[model samples]
Target: MMFMMFSPYSFLFFSTYMLFMFSLFNITNFYYYWSVMELMMLLFMGLSYTLFVSSYSQLMVYFLIQTLSSFMLLVFYIYNLPSLLTMAFLMKLSMFPFFMWYINLIYKFPNFMLWLASTLHKLPPMLMIKLFSLELNTNILWLSIVLTVLFSGVMMLMVLDLRLLLVLSSIGNNSWFLLSQMVNMFVFLFFLVIYSFSLFFLLNSFKGMSKPSLVSSMSSNPYALTLWVLSISGMPPFPVFFGKMLVILSLLMTVDMNYFFMLFLVMNSLMVMGYLQSVMKYFIYIYSSNIHYMLKY
Candidate 1:
């Protein structure tokens, strides 16, 4: 009876979730990891369009890009081409030059897909990075991280939309993902967990908003909004703070990470600025709107 009530989309969502979990067990197996991620992307595209009919074309293009990347990834891995393999994963993760689709499509994601894409979908390629010990040019890596951080910060300053802020913040966090892996797989996993936990609450809060829109204003729960800001900015008292500390410590212990360390501090300041902008706008909204109610009647 319960199965009978399950929509096709729900079933597919569960299947994708199971496949994601199953892939974790086979995380070290290139073939299994590749196959599972390929399958997951296929399911993800289908469900995304099914649920968000208006964004079908965008979803299809994103699908094709990922499919092509997956195939190229296979060929590169087989040839022991670490450079190509690393590039393939970067494209798959939609970092920098390849990020146009991610920015266009993330706004259209149903909240579940948003969380899945932001957190889980990103994991396998990162896992593969560790599995194969692939490395990119240090200059290229530094440049990419710097660009993502700078872009997200600048964009965040202008956006009032909650979902857009979440997207930009996650884009910036991809730098952390890339850097954490350089530290070690364990630190990488720790960072991912901290990120996922913080993002989940942010998403859940937005999900609770009614049909007109997911407003980030104090019109909703203002207290929750403050927590959301802290979560994104990684202020003290949140595990995000500690996760970043450990990454910084690990990077310091590694040679030649001084530049990255300096860049990391700049990135953190930008994150705080961006998220604080979000919360402050809400306070501004409340004060301006509420200061005159019924005009002393």
Candidate 2:
């Protein structure tokens, strides 16, 4: 009865999400985790149907891609084929080379599906990395991160869509995730939680609206929205900074390719600030006009 305060759809979605997360943490058997995740994906597909019938095709594409990733997982389980597990997880998350399909599918997704796919659907693979990421070659991970940020920067320059921009922003934040993953085991989990909260806070502000939602929310809660942007961007004094700071310190301990890591740090910083600048442009223009209009009237 208490949960009935929200619409049934809202209640169901929230409940399913919480359950999925709970199971993700508690489950140890690989097959069990895989089965639970597949079930959650099916539930999300059904839930999306209630509100966004038109997104059926995109969701199916997502499901099929995920199934392919799982087949990779099956091989990894059976034969342990050369980081196939890692590749499967990254492919599922649409990181780096696999981002092409996500780019194509993301635009067609309705707002709700976009939110779930970007934020919630990404957790399982992240959990897998936490359990087994240390064995990865550090140089390769950093190189991929650099490439991801570099590619996202070029695309960020040409995109005007808020959803697309946010998706690209995740490309940068995920670099931090991998850094923290390798730097310290618990730190990865910490950054993941903070990053997810910031993203959820940012996207939830959309409140199920179209492209102008950021401006609309800014007009009402400019300070809150602005701070969320800075936090997500890892601006100093925000919570994300501590996690990143730890990673930077740990990175300094690695002597090989120190210059390369420095380049990555600089490029990644610029990539994040690029989005921050765009957001600030909106805030300054919109917030200033709102203030000026109020003062004049």
Candidate 2: deviation at residue 152, Å? Answer: 1.3
lDDT of 1 at 126: 77
- Per-residue CA lDDT of model 1 for 1-297, tens digit only, reads 222323687667757766676556556767887887777777777656555635467777778888988998999888877667667776888876567678787776766667668887788777777776665556666677777787877888888876787888878888889889888879998999888877767766663311113553323677876786787688887788899889888988984756765876786587778888878887777666677654644
| lDDT of the structure predicted as candidate 2 | 0.67
Evaluate residue 144 in candidate 1 and report its C-alpha lDDT on the 0 to 100 scale. 73
Model 1 stretches astray by more than 4 angstroms:
1-8, 209-213, 216-219, 292-297
lDDT of 2 by residue, 157-177 (tens): 666555677778776666666
Ten contiguous residues minimizing lDDT sum, candidate 2: 209-218
The top-ranked prediction according to TM-score is 1
lDDT of 1 at 179: 83
Candidate 2 lands at a TM-score of 0.80
